[model samples]
Each structure stands twice: as structure tokens, then as C-alpha cells.
Target: MIKILAVGDVIGRPGRQALQVGLAKVRESMTPDFIIVNGENSAGGFGITRKIFDDFINSCGVDCVTMGNHWMDKRDIYEFRDHPQIVLPANMSNVDDPAKGLRILESKSGVRVAVMNLLGKVFMKGENSCPFAMVDKMLDLTPSYVKVRLLDVHAEATSEKQGLGQYLAGRLSAVYGTHSHVPTADERILKNHTGFVTDLGMTGPYDSVIGIDPDSAVRRLRTGEKRNFEPAKNDLWFYGMLFEINEDSGACTGVHRLRFPAKDS
Candidate 1:
């Protein structure tokens, strides 16, 4: 059996702070073979920065980091386009995007796991190919040695996330959603031993607006104004999921949501 710690979006400062505080403990308790985190909003609550990505890996001890729509907000990320550790959306390169969609990592036990990143179309713009179709091609091209295939599907629509889970139910090891910053209640092993979840939630302040300052989010919502939302300053929390896989078949044996108590600051 191989244990993988798959986490949701890590927002701005508060998110970073949460990881800084709890990651080591989580690693010790979970004893995962690998750790994959979503760093799409690891930057300033909107995008990820190189420094943040490095911190997630070096400081937080993440084995792989996947991204979402906000990934493109940082133009400088293109420099690490070819880096094999960071996984971007598969369809992001439809018109010559630089990042790669999926990443594969091999553990010392000879288990190969593929982490694929994709974006849903329910509420997002069309800047690439169809995610459903992209996933199909990716699965077809997956190497035979890789038995554990997991997907991080980032989208705003719950329907889209559910649809993707249904679409990939029997074909993959797991399919998880991100970008919402709040965890869903669905965490289960599908019919074919595939794990699925509507969303893994965010790894930041539980009291804020998706990890941002509540006041700013409210102002923008009420006034239709654009403002810089800062990371929240109270009740920080960390959220993610853990999947236990059968090494021989790469099938998921169990799935569970992991949450650290919210910290009041």
C-alpha cells in the first residue's frame, strides 16, 4: 500500500502560515509516501509565486504541486514551464501556453503515481481544449508502469466537478476538485476502487472569504468593485484529503478528509 497526501488550494499569507505551522505535523501523522498540494492561489490570494512554490516544496515538504486558473496570473511562472515537479492544466497550452498539465513521480517502493491537473468549463473562460477530452487522451497515453492516476480538477461549478467525477469514475485512482477553498462533504471510494470528492477545500483561514479578507470580498460583491483582497487574519485552518492506494493495482483502498483545527489569531 502507498499513502498519498493530496491537499486543496493554498491561498495567500494565511494559507502559507497554516502550512508553515501544520505541514510537519501532518507529515509525521499521515506518514504518506508522497504529498501533492494545490498552489494555485499561493501568491497574493490570486496567483502563485515562485517563492511560494519553493516554500511549498522545501518548507512544507510537498512532493508535487498542482495549479488552477489563477496559475496564469503570474507571468513569471513561465520560466519554470518545463519543470517536471509542478503540474499545470492540460488544456492551458491550447494557444501556446508554457506549463505542462500532468506530472509523474516514482517512489522508492517502485510505485508510479501520475498527478493530472485540469480546469472545468462551467464558470471559467475557454482558453484551451475540452478538459473531458483532454483527460481521455491523457489516460490513453499513461505509461503502463504507472498504476496510480489522480486528477485535480479545478472549477467553480459543483455540477461540473460531479460530472467529472462521474466521467472518470472507473478509469482512474482518484478525482478531486479544488478552487472553492471550502471542502465538500463527499469523500468516497467509487465502484472500481476509485476515490472521488467534489472539492478538497482551501488551506487557509476558515473565517475569511475563501482565504481572503471578508470585508474586501463583501465590498467587491456589493459594489461590483475591484479591490485587492488581503489574506484573512483570523481563524486559520488547513484542509486536504488522504488517499490510500493498493500498490499492485494502483487502486484506491480508502479516502478521508484531513482537517486541522482552525487557529484563532
Candidate 2:
């Protein structure tokens, strides 16, 4: 069995620190063969920076980093988007976007693992293509040798996520949702062996509103004013999912949720 670790969105500094503190424990306990993290918000609750990306890979030992709608919020990303460890959404309508949406990586056990990022349009505002079609194209583009495939569906609507998960049931090893920042209770393996989860939740402060400072988030919602959003500092936690896949068949045999609170600073 190949153990795969999928971490949720990292909010900001606190989130990074939480990973710095908790990832080692997870690694020691679970010993995952591959580690993938949603790093769209790793910079400052907006987008990821090159320095932060390096920290995730070099310091936190992340093998792959996936992004979401906030993929372009930081300027440094343009310089590092070509990095093999990072990937943006595949369905982006902007043909000029240079970042790749799908990537195939080799795990520690020499298994080829295909990872793809996709965006949902149910309630999102963006010029993106159909996620269903994009996924199909990505699967076709992936080499036949790669059997362990994972998709990060960064979307707002649960229905869209569930639909995509069901659509790719027998083809993918796992289908996980992000962007919601709130973890869901439903996690199961479909009859076809695809592991599914609506949302993996955020790996940042849990005491605030989806990693944002509660006061600022409330002000923007209540007064309709644009306020500088900051990442929350309290109640730090690390949220993710652990998957056990059969290497030969590329079928998920176990799906486990991981929620670890950060040590008191």
C-alpha cells in the first residue's frame, strides 16, 4: 500500500508555522510515501510566494503543491510557476496562463502519481472551462503508466465537488475538495475504489473565520467595505487527509482524516 498525505489550504504565517510544528509528527507517525498540500493562500491569506513555496518543500517536506483561485494573488508566483512541484488549475479559460494544471510526479516508492488541479463554476466568478471536461482531458493526457491519480477540486459548491467525485469514481485514486476551508464529515471510498471528501479544511487558525481575522471578516461582511484581511493567529491546527492505495491496482483502500492542533506557542 502507498500512503498519500493531502494537506488542506495553508492560510498564512501561522499556517506555515503549524505545518512546521505538526508535519514532522505526522510524518513520524504515518510515514506517507507522498505529501501534497494546497498552498494557494500560503503567502498572507491571499497567495503563495516563492519563499513560502520553498519552505513548504524544503522545510515542511511537501512533495507537491496545488493551487486554487488565489493562485495568482502573488507576483512571485509567475517566476516559480514552472517549478515541477507546483501546479495551478487546469480549467482556467485564460489560454495565456503559463502555469501547468496537471503534473505527474514520482513517489518515494518510485510510483508515478498524477496530480491535477481543477476549478468549479457553480457559484464561482471566473472564466473557466467545464471542470468535468477538463478532468477528462487531463486523464487522457496523463500517461497510461501513471495509475495513482489525485484531483484537487477547489470549489465553493458542495454539489459540484460531489458531482466531480462521482464522475471520476473508477478512474482516480482520490478526489478531494478545497477552498471551503471548513472540513466536512463525509469521507468514504466509492464502490469503484475512489476515495472522496467534500473538503479537507484549512491548515491554519480555527478560531477565526476561515483563517481570516474574525473582526476584519465581519467588518467586510457587515459594512461592505474592503478591509485588509489578516490571517488569524489563535487556535492553530493542521487539517488534511491520509490515503492508503494499492500500488498495483491504484485503488484506494483506506481514507483517514487528519486534524492535529498546533502546540501552544
> Candidate 1: which stretches are off by over 4 Å?
93-99, 262-265
TM-score for candidate 1, please give it: 0.93
Clash pairs detected, candidate 1: 181-202
Residue 144 alpha-carbon offset, candidate 1, angstroms: 1.5
Can you give the lDDT of residue 220 in candidate 2? 88
**Which pairs of residues have clashing backbones in candidate 2?**
none
Point out where model 2 deviates above 4 Å.
95-99
Tens-digit lDDT track of model 1 for 140-163: 778877889899998889999889
In terms of lDDT, the best-performing candidate is 2
TM for every model, in the order presented, reads 0.93, 0.97
lDDT of 2: 0.90
